[model samples]
Target chain A: MNNRDPENSPVIRLSDICFSYPGGPEVLDHLHLNVYPGERIGILAPNGSGKTTLFHIIMGLLFPQAGTIEIFGEPVRTEKDFRDVRKNIGLLFQDADDQLFSPTVLEDVAFGPLNMGKAKQEALAISRQTLSFLGLSGFEDRITFKLSGGEKKLVSLATVLAMSPRVLLLDEPLTGLDQDTQGKLVSILSEIDLTYMMISHDIDFLEATAEKIYTMKDGKIMVDEGLYIHRHKHAHMLGNMPHRHE
Target chain B: MLDEPFASGNSVIHRLDPRFRVMAAIVYSFVVAIVYRFPALGLALGASLTMIGLAGLAPGRVFYRLLLVNGFVALFWVILPLTAGGEIVYQLGPLDIQKRGIVLAAQITLKSNAILMALIALTATMSFATLGHAMNQLKFPEKLVYLLLLTYRYIFVIEQEYKKILRAIKIRGFSPGTSLHCYKTYAYVIGMLFVRASARAERVYQAMRCRGFAGKFYSLAEFDSSRRNYVFTALMTLTAAGILYLEYLPK
Candidate 1:
């Protein structure tokens, strides 16, 4: 994972990451991942496959029991350290509702810029620009809770984009989106010129937006470059017929 | 569904700045709460009703809100008039309704109704975001204001989560009954909901931190105190002063 020289540090580097819930089996066992500048990486994994936990560890939301995480060549340990790292990295939660906590879309989008110490007017200008970039110009005053699912997802992404982070980590972004919305999201994500790592099960969406794909299983991740094809077989309870799909 | 009953109305009262409305409601409620005499209480109630009418809310909605508030106050009517010892006004089976009790009940009813009506007319017209901004401008505790905003935003999501859990249980052919198994299952459902809510709170906190939240809420909405707002504030002050004088000063 650390094949690159120290002078040309990757955007994010994780080595020997091991984490588990207290008194529980390890969820991430010696996992290693490296994200370089301007790369779009997609991580595909089933539920409870430690993908989200890996994200939390990178974001400093959860501390790894044993690991070394480097964000832009700086080691992150304390809350203050994570604070600096977070300024450069933006994470989109799996649930848009969790991310858009403000009462209105404008406020939610402005929150990050304001927290970064921008003036109120400047933060608001940035928010408006971000929303407009996302093709949501007049949604500033919309109530967050009243938004449709796709609208909420877009607003949540707007909140992160308003921060202008160089690195984006998206978790299950296309889970509940309709096909049209997913297409729109793919286009929006493709146009952005930033390094991003997305965890999603939507194969077509990942193929369109991500340059590299990985799969997680049993607390380990491996590169997956082949086309995604799933096969399943089912037997009827009546024992009359069996069905299979490829 | 979450109801913003008066929030969408277009009226003079609805157009007033939320800060002025909040201030006016506080002063009006104080005046109502302090007034003891029936005449003064009646005056306060009339003022509240006038404001409500000016707000142009539906009559049936107003009546329903008043009924909901008075329903709790109605309990005091039955108990206080019978248990309170004073000059007997009426008699029922094994009970005597006292004159003091009737007066106390009337005072309670008038005060609660007047305050509730004033709040409905004044504060209910503004959206919660406007109300939060007004509170922040008034130097209200930032934590409490943020808590209010978050609660208002996430309550619907939590409700939906609860509904999903109940639907899952129903699909499993679990019908609630007056049995130990039913009670245990219900308790487990509540426990699971709590656990889920706790996990969501943690995730929300993480999301906030990822956006650089540092124990403070930064608001994008700014309220300007324009000439209209000043005029509204002045009128509210004058009305409140008059009410206070009428209720407290010698007539």
Candidate 2:
């Protein structure tokens, strides 16, 4: 929500970024938005409105047809650039299957550590600690593939959270979760100091969770002190939703 | 499927390390394979299946899911004896039933059942990673071990994709008759499966990349499986080995 003062900037900046899938229409139009660290930013858009595409563009998973993404102070140059950047940020996909490919929960969470070349024992310890944090203490030995959808999502976050990332990018993470889990997630998001970028159409989601919001439409983003309700556009709700005090 | 005669109580047999059980079964089965005797193999087979019943790992459901996996092999075994050219035991109308066919069929059934049951008795309920650790302790080839492990990881996914294709076929009103169009659709489905699996592999690989995966797999084993445990396993393995030696041998 802090748009004017650059001195106390929460996060870095993103200038006019445009992206589209191969043979698909321009999903994310010329978009420009600034998100501060410690802010839960929700990108509210329709189903095919390129919400995920924009997130991917930020994560450097998908290169925008045109635009720049700056993290902190450095520009993300290539896939290698995103490697270190990823350590600072975690992207939790809508589908847990996309992230939790390991056979067991411990292995799944330890994946981030394994990537960092942490020793087997050390990785297991980190994973176990994270699991407990996510209230999955006894599930370390359980098979991740056999876990319930809600459990899978929890483990997926546990995997990323184990890394202690500076930013978290979540794509419709509350899709299949029950109300209890949704409530828990809201609290967890609030307590975390990392910058969070979420894509969801749940308007109440923005109000309850995000500190700042951005609406992406026609490849452009507009900022409002309050989340503006708009119809007929890709990114419809970006800006702040009557900012809540921490 | 119903009884678990192999699942002994929480006594010595139940508490015996799975590594010991696996080693014992493997060594015993190898001996039986070499001996090639009817009565001894039969007794060993009976003993193995009995142990699985005792261990109590049977799913005990309407659909014997594990049994379904061996269906194709069972069918092959059932048909093999009929197809073989051997001494005729009887005639079912005009069709000949060979003695060799029946005995060989029995052997096929017994050997596989014995090996699988023994393993099931020991490892069915044991965590797969624990089993992998056992195999690693046993000095199993790393590549072969992960081959089985990865296959287990992906089999459900393959089955699910196949189920989806079949559902699509049912919705399209596919008939039993193998017409050109039907065959074409089947081919398309198969092709689609391969493409989808490949793409999934790519995405998974990308995800792995995001997490810093460098083309290596790590097994985090918490089980305290050391030399001391193996010393105890050695005794169990020797006993199972003795049973096989006594049961199956060339005259």
Candidate 3:
């Protein structure tokens, strides 16, 4: 449904990216991906398929041996170059516990805005607003760890949203959520206006939330056309009877 | 599993600002620590008891905490009475119990209980996070405040990790025994916990950076002192002065 002209450049671009851990096999081997503005991209990959590694590299948390990274049409090279990148690009970690490190919910949610140099009052307002948007009103003074699993998940998302990032990199946002929470997350993700690149192994979840889907294999991602399920004739044990098989 | 169970309350002590609580706890603890005379010690202990009563803490829980402290103080009672050389009070089997030693041990017990009770009544009524924020507002070093807050935040997570590791071990048919294998396995478990903790710390740091954290921690906690806080201050001042007066009283 996007009617933007083709002349518009991608918001994030990674070309010829190669990364490997010390004393380990290559995790990302010359992978390439491009994400345009307002694009909701979903990536599907199994464990240890370099999906997380790719996002880390994109955010400059992990440096690739060889890659040219561009964000907002500028080449990112040094640590100074990545400062603006992290400020504008919010990376939601896989584990909610790792994100909500503050003692209270409001503190954790306000942390991002405060770090972005907003005044204390402004940050508090942003945190409250973000929590209210996530249907977490009146959770400001609640203990962070005392929250239920689903509530922690939403608060973690609030922490990222309070930064008002132009782009979001969500890592396995639906991993351990209950069915009800999963449904809530799907609706929330669909309603937000920001562009995001989410990686998860849940194919149905990807299809529901992402406009374009990609699958990862051998440290590389390829566009996923679709899964095909068709009928075929097969012989059963009962006197060569014909049956439909998938 | 780690929790601040006593932090939630609506008593007068709990309603007092945490900044006041922290400061009062510090001053009162110092006064009780230095006082040696029995009369002043008794007054201080009475004041601590009053504070505890005002806080409305559960008597059973408070007594349990005192029992734990006295368990450690029991050691002092055992050693000090025999070791200290003073006028002999009692004669045991080839051992003399000194009067000076008994008096010293009694003083220590009173001081320890008094300080501990005051701390529980003041600081324990507020969550650790509030205490940290109050310290920050009181001009404590920013780095120290951050350390306290971050430690309080992750202590629960680390405890959960510990439990998870223990459960994994139990699921593998491992049981605690006084054997070399059991000792080695326990050692390895602790080593694994440390390794996991360091790795988690790295990820937490990166997550903080992702949110644009740059060595700055801005707190949104606001501590407003009401008339109750002033009354608390006045009471604390009067208690301290009374204890001092009793200590320096003409004998």
Candidate 4:
């Protein structure tokens, strides 16, 4: 193999990736992208823009109808192929409830580490540290079902964060969070050096968090922007600019 | 028991290897099952209960919880001693109370207590994940282990669904009066529950598949074997072997 260190290559690459739900129009079509380490790219679209479908493809949670996804320079198709890659990539599901299916905050955080073959003590240690990092220390033993929406979102991230992934996929991290929580979340994401990809309709949050933007419409890449929003018809509907910085 | 504290804080029993604890439980269970003599059974019970106490769980609360399950066990075990003829202790009208009745009750209590105490020690000292790891170490069927893993994962999802179902039923003022159609409605409700559970199972399987779950499961919790582990295993093996020998003797 005439090449340099593969590990030093781009962490994520999609070559002509296309997918569709069974019997549906193509949700993602002929999409190509390369994500280097420490990149924060946001997929901006309205509902049904195939954003989540694209995420499922990248996570290897859904097989694309065509095309290929490589995480950390390893092609993922079979389950085993992705297992090692997923260890370094954390996926936050759009619905916090779906993402959080553990009985307690501690157990939730411990899942990924436990899956990664960490000892219970080590898993517990990682969980405690992540909880503290996310400012959810005292709530370790609290029942997850009793947590509010914002807490659920934060704890969900903490679960992935505990795994210590190098790549993070966040599907709408700010949907239901209040302004204060949203601010905190942005700061938290800003601080993590991991390569990040997000899918959201929040324009202001996209501006605050994303260093680059890619738009998908009707199963194809439509636009790529790396700036504040221009005068678009749906731009005013995001309800994000009301976010407070003071 | 209901108030039993799951093993917290650092102690030998809590810190011991998961593998030993699991093996101890199995060997202890086998020994308890075969023991017919009251003395051997009682000794086993005492030793196991002591371990439970050592694990930092309250003995009173454990006993109370055991008492709760005794009703269910007694319903089955009391049959032979009650109807069988034996040395008469006392008589209540036509009914003859005998030594056999007391012996049967003692046997059931001893065996149940021994088995339960072992379980208490194991559970009190280990979290569910450790128990899972321990189970795998003991060569538990992979199917059963994965079932446990799935059950662990989906329990919260099921609870959320249950709450939603409860809320919907409450809002609709669902009350049933005994009638021909009420039973039909209840049957329909049960059928719906099974269908929903089945669908959820399918979805979970797909999700796991997506995540690259092969036949083997990965747990973040690891078992670190130390000199403590060796000592713990030896102590448990000795106790179990002692119990088995005592139980194996002729009645």
Best by TM-score: 3
lDDT of each: 0.87, 0.72, 0.90, 0.75
Off by over 4 Å in 2: A1-12, A16-18, A28-31, A65-67, A224-246, B1-27, B39-43, B46-103, B132-200, B226-251
Q: Across residues A6-29, which tens digit of lDDT does each residue of candidate 3 receive?
A: 788889999989999998998888
Query: Candidate 2, what DockQ?
Result: 0.41
Cα distance off (Å), candidate 4, residue A105: 7.7
For model 3, the superposed segments whose C-alpha errors exceed 4 Å read A1-4, A224-246
Model 3: what TM-score? Answer: 0.94
Off by over 4 Å in 4: A1-20, A23-41, A44-49, A66-90, A96-167, A175-178, A192-195, A211-221, A224-246, B1-4, B9-18, B82-102, B137-143, B176-251
* DockQ each: 0.77, 0.41, 0.83, 0.20
Clashes of each: 0, 27, 0, 11
Per-residue CA lDDT of model 1 for A59-80, tens digit only, reads 8989999989999978888888
Scored against the true structure, residue B71 in model 2 reaches a CA lDDT of 84
**Tens digit of per-residue lDDT, candidate 4, span B106-220:** 7888888889888878765775556766786677886787678557656666766666765766588777789877687678666766777777775544333333345446444
Alpha carbon lDDT at A211, candidate 1: 76
Write the number of the candidate with greater lDDT, choosing between 2 and 4. Answer: 4
**Top-down lDDT ranking:** 3, 1, 4, 2
TM-score of each: 0.92, 0.77, 0.94, 0.71
Provide chain B TM-scores across all predictions: 0.95, 0.68, 0.96, 0.87
Q: Per-residue lDDT tens digits of candidate 2, residues A1-246?
A: 444566755454677787778998887676777777677778776667777777777767788877788887778868888887777778887777778776778878998887787888888899899888778899987877788888888888998898888888888889898888888788777777777888877777666787666776665665665656533523335434554335
Error of 2 at B99 (Å): 4.5
